[model samples]
Target: METLFDSACRYMSDSELIYEITNNKKLVTEAERQGGEYDLNGLFSSLTPGRKKVATAAIELYKRLQSRHNGQDAIRCSQDIDALIHPFLWDLPNEELWVIALNTAAKVIKKVRVSVGGISRTAVDVRLIMRILVEASATQFAVVHNHPSGSKHPSREDENVTERLKKAGTLFDICMIDHIIIAGDTYYSFADEGRL
Candidate 1:
């Protein structure tokens, strides 16, 4: 026989719903959500009861995950990326959308690009990125591309895209972690470097 707790979890996961139980056991709905069960108890156990604020913790943890990353799944650590590009030095320039998908742990679930092409600036439709991130069901995302000019660099264009996407993420409640620029093996993190 299925237990009531199991049924509740199942229903919550399938419907992307979370139920908050009060001290008196009154159930309150927080927000609409997707993905499977989150270890809410385990994640929160370390916090003192007086400070265990579920909603606040979830948002902050999401930010912290993107703030500290190896860039291995999302980016590699060996290269700074900014030091690698030399668009003026090369005849053929290419662009790529670097991405990282994360779970509740703030650990990467996967990394991917939505598009890659010329000039690093030509594409990057902010609207398009919204769909791609949602399709992956990512709760957070980082956008990145190379300058090809070896600058470990971000341009005026880059800043604009980052801002637009950040606002979009906020609107959707999807955490916009950070943006990165990769050239060769080098990487620059927008959040860590404080550019974003």
Candidate 2:
């Protein structure tokens, strides 16, 4: 049987197919940045039946990459946490809250995008954080957010959120590993400074 890609390619001019594939590749690069399960249903709905098959294949590929842990699942330090999350924060112009769920071994189970907002701030509800932790059965978690302003210092709000999460995590028997403020290539760790 012809593959989904082959079916879709039959309907597109060579140039149109090439252009669409290129754009999908760009989307794949930014998949984890979505901060949640990347939903491609809407994108597929907009295409012709044949094209939808192609989009589905692309979406499946993206999902596999987002979940692929390789041998790097265990987070060894703040730097390891930074390396895991940095790709998802790339080129993000606005603020976004990301939660990394971990097993007892410090191996990442998933990365969740809790919220996204204006350039200056993104609101995070501890309840939502709790929900994800419970769902993932995560024994430990780390929080990371970016500042487009290129300053990695934790703001008053960042400290407040860290404290709140720490208190809440304590109640759930879930340890909050660290709260990281990422700016460009640099990062500040709450745990590193004895803040968490």
Candidate 3:
């Protein structure tokens, strides 16, 4: 199968420019390794401002194509959540928490980025999360956050937040499905581990 880089190159108007942009070994390796989740900054850092603009548009188009191809399928398992969410959280230098609101049948209703924080930690506001769930009319939801330090282990604070959210969801008859900690391609899912 042709790699994603090769496929992306075919869409570029100038093959030579794409070749020059992708000339760096690190860029090529990372792009090939991560598929749609590769680092945008690293990909464009060496390019001129004009080239960066072209590259940014190309990347945005690529992401749209990828998401369209993937579709918004039901979340059946932790792996499904990982595949659905990796593109959003991957390549970030800091942490971000997102909520995936699901309908009664488990199909995604919406994805909301709840918070963005420094390298190690981000605060989660339960009230804000509850408000979003209520507004979306979601019957079930999963919370996901990235670990920029590349560890999948949940901290004590992560556990506390998960417990609190689970309790809060009970009051509204909404379900807290899982808490996923993503680090690059790997992830830890509380539901999968019997922690939820």
Candidate 4:
């Protein structure tokens, strides 16, 4: 019977082994030698299980350091909006309503999934969306949902919901910036079309 170390060696390359252990593919190649082979059994046996914990701690520390200098602020235009939401909705088969709460600076504070429904439609709870905005201390928000049918045009229900949310947002001094419908790689924005 093959040992776990032997199996790992047979199944994974040096870079893959390092990535499995470190979860950092960027560290796979070094200046000295590209993906230089190491003694897998020796490496595993000599180290404590705490190596993974150490790596996790290091990653967390790095993220904290980067956040201080990161410019993860508000959207500047339709392109920014597309970049923010397309990844989440592009491949979904059913409809999902995502409400993004934004601060006074228009920076995203939180993204809440108001509802998820059938292939064509998902219910949007205005109260829940408003509650999320209030809880996040958001001054504005944008609504996004996917059309698995590959049509970017808004349905009658979509227009009605947008109107209702606009009214509710105005009442609470919160602005509804846009209603975006995404289908595959394309998107339609109500604000850009002068609907919002």
Candidate 5:
């Protein structure tokens, strides 16, 4: 039976095929030496241009499929919000603020990354957030950001931002449902704690 690599080798140039075989051998050796941990980035970076394009396209396809799968459910709780936003924000080395615009039934309309900041904090523009909600015609929304430091506690800045969003949402008759802080595997929810 032909192996997957054998099948792949049929499509590669002679030089590319040799490089892949050599790289795989080196990666297997390194994995064994490192107790089964291998450099995935190294493996990806070593792929031929065509293979890299295919890999990237495959990844984007997976994300779209996963998003569509998750988007069908109405967000009923903070955990739901966490689940939706975690894949985007969690494990980031820096901070990014995102807003999830929700329809009347709490299904997601759109999720937009509003800002990217340093390791500790990110600034959010309430006007921009509102504009996105308006554009989506969302009646409810949530704010999400990650704490790279792994602190689930909301900072004073977090509190202030939440209050500002809440007030602004009121003005437009759009409800601010939750503000979530993703810290590693844990999370903080303003609505869960009666802070929203």
Candidate 6:
């Protein structure tokens, strides 16, 4: 019976294997000694040389990109829901629903995973979605859930969820622009289909 902790450790171990470019075996050995609790730098220290600089550069580049969007006034971004989902929904497994919360301007303030259910059809409760949106103080939102079937078409359940969320968003004064279903490299958007 592997616990969640074990699963996380497994993911960490796999990451090490995938990114083992540096010969910083000392870092790996230390992390191994400590049962795999290495800080970002400590983990990076164990990488082989080329990967170290590459990884570090990647991080710095990401930081710069994040800085462009980090902590900005929400009133400026009013991004159409399709714009956000199109960039990230592809290739995700089904039963994983992610929400993009936005400020008044429709700019994304946060991306949250509100649920992890079955790979086929997960039960989606509207209240759970509402709760997170409210907690985040988001004024608008776009929802994206993967299908795992590699079909970007929305099912009846997906349509229902979108309608329900739209109605619910009205109550919170949060606009629900679109609900996207992503599978493999394809994606479907409710708004683009004139459903929203």
Best by lDDT: 5
Best by TM-score: 3
Error of 5 at 58 (Å): 4.9
Task: Go through the candidates in order and give the clash count of each.
Answer: 18, 1, 0, 0, 0, 7
Off by over 4 Å in 5: 1-23, 33-35, 38-61
Per-residue error for 10 in candidate 6, Å, reads 29
C-alpha lDDT score of every prediction, in listed order: 0.57, 0.80, 0.84, 0.79, 0.86, 0.69
lDDT of 6 by residue, 1-196 (tens): 9853475535557337434545456666766677766577566655668887887686566544553444354423223443444344444454778787887766667877777777678777889889889998998888888887777778888888899999999999989877877666556778778888
Q: Is candidate 2 or candidate 4 better by lDDT?
A: 2
The alpha-carbon deviation from the true structure for residue 129 of candidate 3, after best TM-score superposition, in angstroms, is 0.6
Winner of 2 and 3 under TM-score = 3
Question: What TM-score do all the candidates reach, one by one?
Answer: 0.50, 0.66, 0.79, 0.65, 0.77, 0.58
Q: What C-alpha RMSD separates each model from the true structure? A: 19.2, 9.4, 6.0, 11.1, 6.0, 12.1
lDDT of 2 by residue, 57-94 (tens): 87666544554543166987888888777766644799
What's the TM for model 3? 0.79
How far residue 179's Cα lies from its native spot in candidate 1, in Å, is 0.6
lDDT of 6 at 178: 71
Task: Give the distance in Å from residue 162's predicted Cα in candidate 5 to where it truly belongs.
Answer: 0.4
- lDDT of candidate 2 at residue 127, scale 0 to 100: 97
Model 1 root mean square deviation, Cα atoms: 19.2
Model 4: lowest-lDDT 10 consecutive positions: 62-71
Show model 2 residue runs off by greater than 4 Å: 1-71
lDDT (tens digit, per residue) of candidate 4 on 93-178: 99999888888898878776788888999988898888888889889899999999999999999999999999999999999999
Write model 3 residue lDDT over 1-196, tens digit each, in one string.
9886677556654333335676566555555566546655555676778877877787677765665455477889888877777777877899999998899999988888899999999989999999999999999999999999999999999999999999999999899999999998799999989999
Candidate with better lDDT, 1 vs 3: 3
